[model samples]
Target: MTKLYASLALGLLAAACGGGGGSAPIATENASAPAPVAAAPAAAPPADSTIDCPMFPASAIFNTRIDDTARFPVHADNAAWQELVGRATPFTANWGTSSNPSDLQDYWGMPFNVVDAAATQWPLVSFDYAASGLVFEASYPAQSDCASSADGSGVVRGCTQVPASQRRFPFPSGTTLAEGGDCGGPSGCGDRHVLVVDKAACRLWEAFYAHRIAGQWYAVATASWDLRSNAMRPDGWGAADAAGLPITPLLAKANEAASGEIRHALRVTFRDAALSLQHVWPARFAAGSDNPGAIPFGSLLRLRADFAIPDAWSPQAKAVARAAQRYGLYVADNGADLHVQGAPDSAWDPAVWQQLRSITMADMEFVDTGAITRDARFAKDSLQAGW
Candidate 1:
């Protein structure tokens, strides 16, 4: 399958970012950038969609424990990136605990759906950016879900390009796109990320700028993966998430917190003005600022080991704080500085999560991931994050 390649200048991609609570900033700096070349994540294990199912195998990067500061010391660039991100930028928990999407205060957290692998699938799509080079030619799920039209045309947008990828995802019928409620119910505008998982098959399908137009689904960019494997997306390929990373695995889930531990890293974003042109290993692309001395994708920021979890905090908050001290958070995308991503669930208590906002960038340090033997070895094209 020879895939049609998109240009580095994907002008039509996410003009608006659902993740950022605003318009998606185009990477004008990457217009002249070359595409990435890398290995796809491969190998796998038996899978299931059950609640107790693990997000990924133990060896997967998300599950790798990085709190051993003795072995994984702070990166040399840690101080610089921290200073650049600003010490005063407070940590903002960007998810809702309420189940009612309409009850969201801000543009609520990103949403995901789980379904059986055998569910009906559709390849209905069309790329908006000049990202033909990034298209993987895989099929995606589209169950004829429709966003009510503003124009009342009663015409469904047929596929000029059929785009759901090789793996299938299906949001339960009527699942709202991320920020869907805040933007304008289902017809709203925002990053509109749609993440669907096949629990039984251990597969995930994600799309950016997703919408159901005229009784059909559509997106500018999309990516899919087999959760049970460690191989990455083919080097240089674009994914729905800005960093070319999976969105859900890194999310701060209430259920995980209830279990008393978050084994994997959490997802975070900083302002694009401070993003680096370069991305690290595990991050297939750079989706932030072109500014020099800017932060880069795949950067790790750990809560200082000495930072104490206040006794007054909720158990969920304590669990997240402990995870930050241990597994830490990854600079997964370009968004507001210090904003941590999570799923919207009623289980998330607003009171406790609010307390997490006090831990600012001043309390964190970056991990020099190149120090790790397993992480450093997964190089893509000529790009490598390890020292």
Candidate 2:
């Protein structure tokens, strides 16, 4: 983690200092200067818009954990990427040992490996946008009843028809449990799933750990509800439906049935362009604080090639060069003095340059200029083809 942070800080510093090994900043024309690159086409709008509402419904459920043999492929549309980037808002919590009971500490205090471990799991869960659904695969130790069913033949079968008496308690003999919940229940789960609408926060909260028993999946835990404003009702507007019952009774039953110690990985889909913009742009703007207003319109530009430093440079020099490559430098004039942004930091880690590179100039805007000199002596002797 420290090494990663150091590497990132170097990139940031290089970007701030400008000019080492990274791609040169896009040359902007002075008022009299001619334009270089043509304006890029606008990005297409997202496919859905309703998913952007803050109060939109969400759910968390457990699923049957599969062995390493069960493969979970990446979503064809890269919805996982969108969800992660959208939800990358700063979160603070205590860090703790993987299994040790009393090792809790602040969230960011945890090692990067721990954070990465959890993040990598995002794509492991399955998602369906048309149905607004999510499913997790979990595993529990093998049990006698599970073996009796069909010698593991029926384990992967779709949702079972649990009787009313059997539904009230945990599944009889599976070692693992997997859960799923969606806006529409008939397609996601029959009697086992609960539905919730307009309660986005609660759904997000519960989904974090609705699956996993002793580090495995044992059974599916599901919920569904409707979010509505009711002046006549307490708590104002809140969730209403879950697997068919009102929210209150469902929650009480959930608490009594399980310890509520569940971990979940959420995969959100952008229904339309509006939601994508709302979720992605602000984060980029905030991250560019080091460069201040230098990043154009908060757009990230892809690099033509991966920048690398040759072995000829000393380690320290190589570090500087690497930073320069990862974070392109900008030479801007502030009104009072020349200042540099994106300097490497000792505290912060460098994010993937590739991701940053994917942004374009149109996505960013030049909010301010630092300083410029009009004196002939300060001007270049001859016009340089590229800056």
Listed in order, each prediction's TM-score against the native is 0.74, 0.18
List lDDT for all candidates, in order: 0.61, 0.20
lDDT of 1 by residue, 49-150 (tens): 243345655656666678889878988888888888888888888787666666657437886777554553443454332234332233221211111122
The TM-score, computed over Cα atoms with residue i paired to residue i, of candidate 1 is 0.74
Alpha-carbon deviation at 16 in model 2, angstroms: 53
Stretches > 4 Å off in candidate 2: 1-98, 106-153, 156-160, 164-387
The alpha-carbon root-mean-square deviation between model 1 and the true structure, to one decimal in Å, is 10.6
Decoy 2 TM-score against native: 0.18
